[model samples]
Target: MNQASSTTTSGSAAGMHPREFVAFIAALMAVNALGVDLMLPALADMGAQLGVATANHRQWIITAYMLGFGSGQLVYGPLADRFGRKPILLATLAGFVAASVFAAGSQTFAALLGARVLQGLMSASTRVLAVAIVRDRFHGRQMARTLSVAQMIFFLVPIMAPTLGQLLLNTLGPWRFIFYALAAFAAFVLAWSSLRLVETLAIERRGSLSIAALGSAYRLTLTNRFSAGYAIAAAMTFGGIIAFVSSAQQIFVEEFGMGDRFTYLFAACAFAMGVASFANSRLVERLGTRLISQAAVLALIALSVGHIAVILLGVESLVSYMLFQALSMTCIGLCGSNFGAMAMEPVGHIAGTASSIQGFITSVGAVIVGSLIGQSYNGTTLPLAIGYLGIGIAVLGVVLVVEEGRLFHARQAP
Candidate 1:
């Protein structure tokens, strides 16, 4: 692999191979998942220490971060387009590290929530740039395959993070130390990226930084039927996953009495997702994005329906819940990367702005839906199961609109 020098005008990968590029991008994006998943094991301890009033109120920690993460995407997308990816990414990483430190020292629940929001806002750069970078280098089905491979690696973080969090909580004996660990991890990523990543956006191809230009880009993105439809579909499907994440700890610990075993159960579901993503990487090239995603949506809907029926019948056990949840996540694993690639496929010229708009819509929308479902937790898995079913059906409708009622038909090659 060729190392990126500071002197290049048009950014190159510095002779980085596809696997290495995929690994680097996956690591960057995984920070977002790590930020959320790693905190799950510590939520109860932190909430008690910080004087949280209710168990449900503790969810504000996750919700606050998501809101800031979503809102900040709008800012970073445009700036990355105007200023270039490398500088913006580096700055954002630094901000994330600082916010992590702030959160670690927070003495009040409100203060910790605020710091988490800042950390999430800063981390938005990693998510947005990771997608923009992939779009920078590839388009269409190849982009779908590349993203699937990256996601397959990214899923490993979710699989291991909770266990890691649990270990840290056991050894450090304080939840705040987790935030300190987060700061250290972000610092390492920042250092590695600073030394290796080259700017992918060329100077001449950059859009103007004026409000008028921004308005035009926004207009173009929203008015494009393909991009807009797929964005909505992605948002709804994404909501289902967010809902599961928000409720997983409660479902495993309180509902099923899994106790300390919750992390392993969570990891089991994550493993399913990782396997599904790897399968998507292999199948996307032959089956195409639309077919794979469409089929996965149907499978998700079926699993959700079955899960709801079992719950209603009073036959749902911990094993049954895990089985259904794993199947649902597997379907999500198949849909996510493909849906994102399809949405961004036609908007590569304005990749940063396009990604920002889409990211904003999906993240904010999912947060709203997920928060509602999470807040409805009644010491049972009913709400989560119904939420998955509702979101799956909603996204299928959106996908139909995107495809103009055509399912599984591949678009012409670019």
Candidate 2:
């Protein structure tokens, strides 16, 4: 096995042996997803069994974790750049594992939320580091291609994680068991990562991590109109996913009357979306992220409009709304990976910090944004669709700013 790390590889890189690199990146991307997805099946029951009354509070379980995850990225990114990716990563995993144990043993929903918050706070390192790894290993189209492939596999979590959580819920007879499983999974990753990983960030390459870097990272990203546009564009799009994460279980089991079948149904929707994203990764380079995103944003808007229309038109069946929502999610498959790559392209000097900022906005800001959108649920899909339409317009506008032209009329992305 070649343990030699090459920093010179290009897109679809040959002689680079993409398999291990791919696995490593995918694993990194998926770490945070595990905490998010695995706990989904347990959301409803966890609320009830853990003494959470007023279903609205239950949504916070997901939102609070994301909130912490977002906040923690600011610290992790600089630490990785200033210290080293591996050390920061291992330390974060330790926090995640310990928090998971706390969550599993918690006596109440509030206690469980505290643990989830801690778990998410630490796990934030993995998310930022995953993107930083891309910066470390490749650049330009090569980086995009690598990220797309890695993201494709990374997406499989949404596809199977809920179902797996449901299986644990049924066999183990309580929702807390899911955290036990999470602890085990995090522990395994921590062990494997410690043994196999090398320092991706060169020690001498780091700049001062003073508050100045964070401010500078933000300034550079925002001042570069193209990068800012892309970053905001990615945030607008992925915020929808965050909205869904906070509310899908509630919508399925409570609003839609799906009962325990929520997990199975949730998994089905996630798989459909994941498949679309996997396909997008393959075609993005050829299609161009700008063109592809334009199409996706347009399609997502159509789906959102159609959803509201279908509901107002008396199409109240679960399958009716589910199909439209599922269709809408296909757009997510396209937006998340490409938008992410585009955003990170320009901030190479502070790639780790840029990643943290990106994750911070997407996860932290998204939680606040997504929570507001999720809380507006009025026994209909309008709130969700309305959320999508608003975000879609914002995403479209950001793309316009990024491309420096009207939608579809931009001859080339700026």
lDDT values, one for every candidate: 0.87, 0.78
Off by over 4 Å in 2: 1-6, 9-17, 211-215, 408-414
State the TM-score for model 2. 0.92
Error of 1 at 98 (Å): 0.3
List of clashing residue pairs for candidate 2: 11-142
For candidate 1, the per-residue lDDT at 358 reads: 89
Give the lowest summed-lDDT range of ten residues in model 2: 1-10
Candidate RMSDs in order: 3.2, 3.4
Per-residue lDDT of model 1, residues 377-402, tens digit only: 99999999998998889988988887
- Give the least accurate 10-residue stretch of model 1, judged by summed lDDT: 1-10
Task: Kindly provide the TM-score of model 1 when superposed on the true structure, using C-alpha atoms.
Answer: 0.96
Query: Which ranges in model 1 have alpha carbons more than 4 Å from their true place?
Result: 1-11, 412-414
Tens-digit lDDT track for model 2 on 1-414? Answer: 111244543223322246877887788778788888887877777887888877777888888888889889878887777887788889889888899999989997778878878988988998899888778776655667777788778778887898888789778988878888888988888887887776766666676778876688778866877666676777676778878877887788777889767877877777767777677767766766767778999899888888878878887578986787777788877777777777777786688878887778777667767888988876667788889989888888778766766665424333
